[model samples]
Target: MERLSLTLALGDYEHTRDLATGQVPVQGVSLNVLTLAPEEAFFRFTFFREWEVSEMSMGKYVSLRSQEDKGITAIPVFPSRVFRQSMIYVREGGKIDRPEQLKGKRIGIPEWAQTAVIYSRGYLTHQAKVPLGSVEWVQAGVNQAGRVEKVKPKLPEGVRLRPEPQHSLNDMLLAGDIDAVLSARPPRGFGSGIRRLFPDYEAVEAAYFRETGIFPIMHVIVIKTDVLERHPWLAMSFYKAFEEAKRRSVERLSDITASHAPLAWLAPYTERMKNLFGEDFWPYGLEKNRTTLQAFVDFAFEQGVCHRRLELEELFPKQVLTSFKV
Candidate 1:
């Protein structure tokens, strides 16, 4: 039987390297993988549909789905999961020393629907007791001018959102035009005097994980609806392949013969993560990630990034929802 050939746009990460290099094969399918940075991958795919399968932001996916855009659908394979406590950037000597000070302050963001920004806002509003309405919001690119939100937002009343296409968040924060910036990517010229709002975010993130059990999902694998229409099994095939690749990466990393990662204590850190998250630190699918998925859904809606709240199960194709146990 001839295999289905699909183009997949993804970031070049250690976890995805196996699949990208064809070291691990997808059953009955051929993946023409394009390794790209997260931002470039998203922009290229969003604007050009350059690939049939791509890594997409959970926030943008949810917001787009809420608007009934049928361009793409997702599998539960998340290529990137990160905590956003470290995403908030502030000037070296800024008044926004803590999350509480962000209230009633002007802050810049690349987009309203950025997954990292959504979680940063959620943690600030819900966990840190800062009201969304209290802060004035500015939207723009992190390092360049003229970036805009791909999805339209329906912001709640009293939540001010101003677009500053004339300047990037980096410039705005540096010029004192904005108090702080929320971004997934570090802004250009971000060093020396500029640093994270919480330089001690490592400890903060650890505490947050213990309290909330949310590791914060950043990106998911999306298949163009047209591709899936002809082959529904593509979803499961892709999911299983990704799962196997991830499992193998973790296994290799844990092996002591040669260091899979450059870290001096990679094995010990990997073991620590397992203890922290229970078995697999990075898990795919619905049941294992229900809490993180539900919280993200809630955050998207509350932040007005999504027009309506989404149910977790409805987010992915039904084929990847269940697994056959041997």
Candidate 2:
């Protein structure tokens, strides 16, 4: 049989390294991997359906899925995971010193439904006791002016979100127009005056993980519905290839002498990550990740990003949901 040829658009992640280079091959298929910046990929794929397969924002995916727009469906493959404690940027000597201090203040976000903002606000409202209704929310680009929300937002009842079409969050923060920012990207010209709200954010994030067991998910892999409908087996094949590629990537990094990571103590850090997380710290599939996935569903619905809460089985194909093993 002729191998199925497909295009996959994704970020240049360490895990996807082998697949990108063709060192890892998908079973019975040929892949054309297009490495794109995260912002570009998310926007292009979301609006245009530009690629047959893509790495898309979990928040946006869930939002679209909730609306019953079934252009694409996802597998369990997550390409990006980030801890959002450090994503929030605040002015030094500002009124907001702690997460709770954000209450009743102005908080700027690139998008209210951004995955980073979802996790940040989830921790704040659920853990730090910041009431969702207390603060006024502002939406705009972090650095550039006139950034617009690509998808229509479902802002919750009593949530105050003011969209600034004319100014950037960077300028707003510097000018004291907003008290703090919940952004995944740093503001342009970010320096001394502006700093992380938690100076010891690493410790804060590690503790949050210890307590919550959530390494917040960002992007997920999706296949166009038409392609999947025609080639149903491709879902499991793609999952297996991604898993294998990630395994090779891990093996290469764990080899101490090769210096796969730039840090001097990288191997030790890898071991520590093993101890802290698991043998495979970054895991795909549903069972190992249900808690994290469930939290995201709850967060998206609470923040009004998704019109309806969705479960994993509803979001992904049945084949990738479980595998038949030897």
lDDT of 2 by residue, 1-326 (tens): 99999989989998999898898888888889899998999889988888799999998899999999899999999999999999788887777778888888999999988888899999989998987889999999999988888677788889999999899999899889999988989887467578888888989999999999898999999999999999999899889999999998888778888788677877788898899999989999988899899999999899899898887789899988777869
Cα deviation in Å at residue 59, candidate 1? 0.9
Error of 2 at 232 (Å): 0.4
Candidate 2 — worst ten consecutive residues by lDDT sum? 186-195
Give one clash count per candidate, in the order shown.
0, 0
Model 2 RMSD in Å is 1.0
Error of 2 at 117 (Å): 0.8
Candidate 1 per-residue lDDT, tens place, 121-198, comes to: 999998889898999999999999999988899999889999999999998888888888999889885786679988
How does candidate 1 score on lDDT?
A: 0.89
Model 2 bad stretches (over 4 Å): none
